[model samples]
Target: MGRHSPAPAPSAAASAAAAAAASSASTPPPRGGRAPRDADADSPSAAELRGLLEDGDGGAAPGGGRELSYLQAVNFAGGLLLPLRLPSAHAIHKRPSAAYLEAGTLLGEEAGRLLKLAGPLFIEGITNIGAQLVATTTVSRLGAGPLALSALVLAQTQLNFGYSIVCGIAAAMETCAGQAFGARHYALLGLILQCAMALCLLFAVPTAALWASGAMAPLLVRLGQLPDVAAAAGSLLQLMWPVLPLLVVSETTGQYLLAQGVAAPASVAGLTSLACAVPAYWWLVGRLGWLRGAPAAQVSLQAIAAVVVVAWRSARDARVARTEPHRATWRGWSFEALRGLPTYARYAVPAAAMLCAEWWIWEAVVFLAGLLPSRAEVQLGALGFVMQVSIATWTLSYSIGTGAATRIANALGAGHASNARRIFVLACCLLAVANSAVAATLWCLRHRLSAALTPDPEIGAEVRRILPAAILGVVGDGQVAVLGGLLRAAGRQSTGALIHFCTYWLFGLPAGVLLGFVFEWGALGLWMGVASATALQAVALHAWVALGLDWQREVRRSAATVGALLGSTGATPTPAAAPARSFAIAGLEEDGLTEEEEDGDEEGGGGGAGAGAGSALTSPAGAGGGSGLTSPLLGGRG
Candidate 1:
C-alpha cells in the first residue's frame, strides 16, 4: 500500500535528469567546455581505460582452451608409446641423456604420420633436412680423422651445451620473427636470419676449431679425468674438428628452416649426414680396415666421413640461405637486436653450464661403471643397454614435450595467454597417458627384452628384476622433459637450468651414488635415484611454468641479455616492450608447429625487427588461416 501511494508521483524521468545534471555539475568540463559525444562521455578514466585495454587486447584468448580430440589422443599415445619400443634402435646408444631421444619419438612418429597421412605433399612441405641427420643417424660416422673421431665423440658430450645454446638463440629469433611475420615483416626475417647465421658461425665454427686442436683434452684433464682416456678423447676431438663448420651450418640453417615451417631442409641435412656418415664409418673402418686400433680407427674414419658429408651439406645450405626472399620492408637493424645479446647470454650461459654438469655426471657414471670389477662392469654395460632402450623412449616424450613447447611459445608470442594455458594442460594430459602406457609395455616385455639384449642368464635376470624401476624412472623422466621444455618455451631457461642443476647434481647423482655404491643397491638404486631426480625436476619446472610467472619481463630481460651479446657481433638492438604479466595456457592446438619454429617466430618477432622474424613466409599452420601452429618449440635439446 505504501509503495502504491509513493508510485503515484511517477517522477522517474525527472529524477534521473536532475541527478545527471547534478553529477555533471560536480565534475569539471574539458578545457574548451564543449559537450562531449557519447563515445567520449562513456570513455573510461585512466585506470578504467587501462583495464579496458587489458581486457580487450588479445594477449590471451578465451575460446580456444585445449581439449583433446580423438586424433590428438591417438597421436599422443602413439608418439609416447612407440618410442618406448623403438628408441634404442634409433639413437639411444650415442646421446647423453636419451631424454630427447625418448621424447623425440613423438616427433619421429609425427613426421612419419604426417608423411603417411598427407603423403608426398606433406613430406615435401614439412621435412627438416638438418634434423634428419641428428635424429636418423650418428654424426660420428661423418669424418675419418683419428683426431676428428675423438673430437666428435667428445662433441657428443658437448651436445647438451650446444642444444641449450641453440634453443635459447632460436627462441630469441622466434619471438622477434613471430611478431614481424604476423605484422608482415618479411624484411625483418631476412635480416634476422643473416644476423643469426653470423652469430652461429662465430661461435660454432670457433668451437669446432678448438675442439679439433686437441685443446679440449686439457679441459677434460682439468676436470680431473685420467690422462689416457683424455688423450684418446683429445685425439678423437682433433680428428672431428674439421666438421665444425658443417655442424654450425646445419644447426643454424635447421633452425631457420624449422622456424619458417620448411623443416625438410633440417631433415634433409640430417638424412644426408646420417646416410653418408653411418655407412661410411662401418665400410671404411669395419670392412676396408682403413686404420689400426679398432675404436680409434673407427672413430677416425667416422670423423672424415662426417666432415665430407657436413661440408657438402653446408654448401647446399649456403645456396638455400642465399636464395631466401629479400623483402623491401626489411627495416634497419634495431638497438634491441644488439641489446638482446646480453639477455640471451645471461640465459644461455647458465643453461650451458647446467647442460655440461648433467653430461659430466653421466659420463662419470659410465666411467665409474667401467672401473667396477669385471663382472660388475659387464653387468653395468648391460644396464647401459637398458638405459639406451629407455632413452629411445625418452625421445618420444621429448618430441611431444617439444610440441608442447611450440604451442606455449607460439601462444605467448601471439599474446594469447589463455591459449598457452590450454596447450600446457593438453601436454600434461598427453604425457601422463603416454607414460602410463610406457610403464605397462615395459612391464610386459621385461623378460623378453632383457633376454634379447644379453646372453648371460644371470645378467638378464638381474636386468629383468630392475626393469620395472627403470621403466618407472623413464616415465618420470619423460614428464620432466616436457616440463623443462615448458620452461624453455616460456623463455625461462634460467629457471629450468636451476631445476636441472638441483635435480641432477644435488639429488639424482648423490642419491644414485649413495644407493649404488654405499648401500650396494646396484642397478635398482641407480634407477631409483634417477626416478627421484626426474620427479623433482618435473615438479619444479612445472611449478614455474604453471605458476605463469611474469613472462613479459622474462621476455624483456632475455631480450636485453641476448641483445648485449649480439651487440658485440655488430648487431643492433630494439626497444623493450612493457614487462609482461603472469600468464597460463588453458587449451592449445594438438599439432602446433615444430618446437623451434613456434618459439622462433615469437623470439624473432620480439628480439629485433629482423627480416626473417616478420617475413610473409608460410606460417606453421600453412597458408590456410589455420592458427599457424607450425612453429618449432626451439627446445629440441634432445
Candidate 2:
C-alpha cells in the first residue's frame, strides 16, 4: 500500500465555516439557498453520518446520502481521528492550553494501566522460578558438591525443554482467547481454551515418556557429560517426570485466565505453591539431606500450582454463572473443542518452534560447558547459577510482554488500531526502563549474588567472572520478550520461529562454539556469543515491529480469525446478534457515536443494532472496505 501523509490541520477560517455549515444543516438553510425541508432531506441522517465516518470515505454515503462538502468531511474525519493524533495548538488552546498537562496525564494513565496488568503476572513468574532457585540454594547449603549442582542443572534443562514446548503450544491461546474475549465471543474463548489444553496434553505425553525413560543418561553421556553426572541427572529427571503434564494443565489454564485479564488466581496459586514447596525442600533436602528431595519438591510445586489454578478457574466459572452468566466463558467440554484443534495448531506449531528454538540453545550452551577440558564441574555449576539468574530476569520481562500482548490483541480484535500501537509503544518504554534498572542492580551485586548462589569458591569466582555477559543478555532478553509478544498478538509466530532459528541456531551457537572451543575463552566466551546473538535478535525483532507491522491489517485478521473459529464449531455469539464484523467493530470508538446512539441509529435504519455502524466500514461495497485506502496512519487491506 502507498503511504499518505497525515491530514493537514484545518485553518481557523475553515473550522468556522465547517461549524457554521453544520449549524446551518441542523437548522433551516437561508430562504434563497434551499427549502428548509429539502435541506434537511438532503443532509445525511445519523446512520449515513455513521457510515461516512466508519468507512473513512469523503464522498456520499453508501446508501446514496447527499455528498458532503470537503470542509465538512475533513472536519468530521479529523474529529474522529483526533484522539489518535498528537494534540494540536489550536485544539489544545481551545481547552485552556493544557496540552502538555493533558499529554502527561494520558501518559501516566496508560502507564498505570499497563503496570496494573503486568504486576500480577510478574509475581506469578517470580513464584514460578522460586522453586528452582530454592532447590539450587538448598543444594548449595547442604554442600552437595558441583556434581549435584551440575546434575540439577541438566535435569532442569530437560524439564525446561518440555515446559517450553507446552508453553509455546499454549501461547496460541494468548492470541485466540484474548481476541475472542475482546470480541465478546465468550463461548469461543472456552472452546479455544479447551483446544489449547488438548493440544498441550497431546504433546506432553511423549515428553514425559522421554523423561521417564533410561535413554536420557546415555544421551547426555554421548553429548559429553561425565558418566556420574549423566546418571544423576537421569535420576532427577525420573523424579520430575510428572511435571510435564501438570505444566500443560497449569500453563494452559493460566493463559486462559490471563487472556481475560484475570491474573489474581494464578498469582495466588504461584505464591501458595512456592510457600508450600520451600518448607518441603528445607525438610527433605536441607534437613534430611536427601539429594533426590530437590526434584521431588519441584514435582510437588507443579502439582500444587496446577491443582490450585484449575480449582480457582472452576470456582470463578461457577461464580460468574451465578451472578453474571453472560460473562462466563466456560461451557462444559464438548466435541466443538475437538473440531477446533486443527485451527489451534495452525498457530501453535509455529509458536512451539519459536520458543523451542531459543530455549534449546541454552541447553546446548550448558552441554557445551560440560565439554570443557578442565574444571568442567566448576564451569557447569557456574553456568547453572548464571542461567538461574538469567531465567529469573527473563520471567519479569516475559510477564510484562504477556500483559502487553493481552492489551494489544484486545485492541486489535476490537478494531482499535491506534490503541494497539499506543500500547506497543508504552510497553517498549516500560521494558526499557525496567530492564535498565534490573541490569544496574545485577551489575552492582554480581559478586555477592555469585557467592550466595554457590558455596564453592571456584564456581562463585567463575560466575562473577562471566556475570557481565549474563547482564548483557538480560538487556537483550527484555527487548525480545515484548517484541515476541507483539508477534504473537499479530499471529506471526511463524515469522518469530524463523527469526529464532536464524539468530540463535544458525549464528549464535556457531559463534559461541568458535569462541569457547577454538579461542579458549571457555564459559565466558560462550555467554558472550549468546549475548551478542540476543542483541542481534532484539534488533531484528524491533525492526519488524517498527517497519513491518500493520495494525489495521491485524485488526481485520483478528476478526477473520475469530469468525473462522466460530464457524468451524457451528456456534454463534449470543450477545452479539449482529453479523460477525459488526460485533468486531462494536468496540471501536472512531465514529463519535455512543453504543446507545449507534444502536438507535441502526434500529431506526431498519437494521439490527451495530449493523449500520460496521456494515459500511467492513463490507466490500463500502469505500476503503476490503480494499483499503493508502493512508500511512491506517494500515492497508488484509
Candidate 3:
C-alpha cells in the first residue's frame, strides 16, 4: 500500500483527438456555404458532442479520430478545475419538481426512507445491549456482595473503553464506504472495509495485552479501590481479553454491511445471540455458580455476531457475483488496503476521541459516585442503574443518528446537496419527536422501571430521584447524537472531538464535581450537571450545522474523499478523473437545461451551456476551478 504514483499524462494521440473534438464543437460552420441537409443530418450536433463529453462515451468522432473518455478530457484540460465550478442555487432549483415538490410530500418521503434504515438498526442496538444486560443480571444473581457487582462494573467499564475505539474506526467506515457505495464507486467499498478490519484488529493487540497483563487491578487499587474488588476486576478483565478481537470483527463487518444498507443480517444475528446468551448465562452462572460464566457468555455472544456477519458477507458477495457481476464489491485482499491507512486514521482518530470523551465523562461521574462521603455502595448501585437506563434510551438516538449519517454521506457522494440537507433536517425532526415520546413514556414509568431493575429500596429510591435529570439528559443526548452524525457524514470528526472535549471535560465534569462534592447534591446533582452540559452541547452542534455547514462544499469534499480512496487502491481506470463524474452530473442536473434550452444557450454562447463547458474545461474531475486548487484533496470543513 505504498503511496500511489500520479496518474500518467494523456497520450499525444488522445490529446490531439480531444483538441480536434473541442475545436470542431466550439467553432461555428461557415455561414456562406452551409452543408446540405443530408450531410448536416449525418454530422453530430454541438449538443451531441457536449453529451459525448459529459457522458464519457467511447466512440469515433466526426473525423474518424478516437474520442477521449470523459476522464481523459478532464485530465487533458487540467486537474484542479472540475470540483470548484459548481452550479449555483438557482440552477439547482431548476430541475423539474426539485423546488416544486410539496414540502409535505418531501418530508413524508424522507421520513419513510429514514425509518427504513433506522428500524433494523434500532433492533440490532437493542439486542446487542440486551445481551450485555443479561450478563449483568446473571452476575447480580450470584449474591448481594458489593465485591462481585463492583468488580463486574469495573471490568465492563474497561472493556467498553477499548470497544469504543473499535466502534470509532467502524464509524469512519460508515462515512467512507457509504459515500463510495452511493457514488457508484463499488470497488472502493471492499478496500475501505478491509482497512477498517485491519485497523481494528491491529488496535486490539495492545488493548488485549493490557487486559491480560493484570496491571489494571494494581492500578485501580492505587487509585483508592478496595484490593479485593480490583483483583476480581483484573481476573474478569483477563477472561474478557479474547472478546476484543471478536468485537473488532463484529463491529467492523456489521458497519460495512450497514453502510451498504444491508442491516437485516446484523439485526437477526443480534437477536439470535441475545436469545442464546440469556439461557447460557442462566445455565452457567445461575445453576452452575461459575463467576467466569458471565464473561464467557459475553465472549460467546460476540463470537456469534462476528461469525454470522462474516457468513452473511460471503453469501452476499456470491449472490452479487452471480447476478450483478459488474457491481460486485469485493475483489480479494491486496496491498491497497495498507495504502488507505493514513486516510482511515484521518477520520478514525478523531472519531475515537469524540466517543471516548463522552464515555470517559460518564465513567468519571460513576467514579464520583464512589467518592460520596457515606452510603457509597448504594449510591454506586443507583448511579449504575440510571446509567443503564440512559444507555438503553440512547440506543434509539444512536440508530437514528447512524441512519442519518448514512443517508447524508450517500447523498453527498452522489452530488445531491439539496437531498443531503433535507435528510439532516428530517433526521432532526424525527429525533425530536422520538425523544419527546421516550421522555414522556419514561417519566410515566420511572418508578415502575426502577423497581423492576432492582430489589433494594434504597437503590430504587435513589434511581427515581435522579430519573428526571437523566431523562432531560437523554433528550439532549439524542440531539447531540444526530448532530454528531452530520459531522461524521462530512468527515468532520475532529470538530466533533473538540466539541465533546469542551462540553464534557471543561463544562460537564467540572460542574458535576462542584455540585456532587462541594454542594453535596449527590447523584442527582451530578446528573443535573451532565444534563445541562448535554443541552449546551446540543445547542452548540445545532448552531454549527445551521450557521457553518455548506452542503455544496460537502458534496465536493465527499467527491475528493471517495476519489482519494479510489486513487489509493488503483481501482479507478483514470485516477485523475474519478471524481469528475460525481460533480459533473450534479452540475448538469442542477442546471436543469432541456435539449432546446441547451441548443439555444449554445447558439448564444452564454448562460447554462457556457457555464457547463467552462465548468468542465476549468474544473476537471470535480476539482474546483480557479482558487479551489489551493485546497488540499482530503481537506474538509472543521
What are the per-model numbers of colliding residue pairs?
A: 161, 0, 12
Off by over 4 Å in 3: 1-103, 143-145, 286-289, 573-634
List per-candidate RMSD values in Å: 15.6, 11.0, 13.8
TM-score on alpha carbons, each prediction: 0.58, 0.76, 0.76
- For candidate 3, lDDT tens digit of each residue in 1-638? 01222323443444554465555546676796432221111223445334444432234332122122332222222221121223232332232223223333435545665676777788888997788777777788773466777788778888888988888878898678876765556667788988988888888989899888988889889988789988999988888898999988888888777666666776778888988987888877766454577778778778888899899888887887788665577878888778988877788889888888888888888878888886888888899888888988899998888888877776666555555676777788788888999999999999899999899999999988888888877778788989999888888999999999999899988898888888988888788778888999999999987667767677668767766776666665212222221222201122222233222111101111111111111221335322123344444547
CA lDDT of each candidate? Answer: 0.46, 0.68, 0.68
Candidate 1 per-residue lDDT, tens place, 1-638, comes to: 00111112212332333355457546776895443321101222345223322322232222111111111222233323222111222231222224334545544443332222122212222222222233223333444544434444454565445544544455444434333333233444445555555555666677777766768778888977566557766665565454444444444444443333333443343344445554555554455432222334334433543354345435544554466433232344454444345434444455455445545666656655554544675557567767666766766666556545544444444333333444455566666787789878888888888988788877777778667877877767667766765665555656666777788888987898788777877766666776788788777766765454544333222232222333333432232222222111111111223222322322112111111121122322112112222332122121
Deviation from native of the Cα of residue 491 in model 2, angstroms: 0.6
Q: How far is candidate 3 from the true structure (C-alpha RMSD, Å)?
A: 13.8
Q: How far in Å is the alpha carbon of 548 misplaced in model 1?
A: 5.0
lDDT of 1: 0.46
Model 2 C-alpha lDDT per residue in residues 1-638, reported as the tens digit of each score: 11222333443333443465567657755675523321111333445444433433333232221112221232233222212223322332222124334445545655665566677788888887776678877777773698888788778777887888999999998778877665556677788988998999898988788878867999999977789999989988877889998988888998887776666767888899889976888877865454578877788888999999999789877887788676578988888787888878888999999889988898789878989877887887788789879888998898888878876776565555655676777788788888999999999998889879889889889999899899977878988888889888877888889999999988899999888889988898888888888899999888876666656667667666666567666555544323222100111113222333222211101001111112112221112222132222221121
Better of 1 and 2 by TM-score: 2
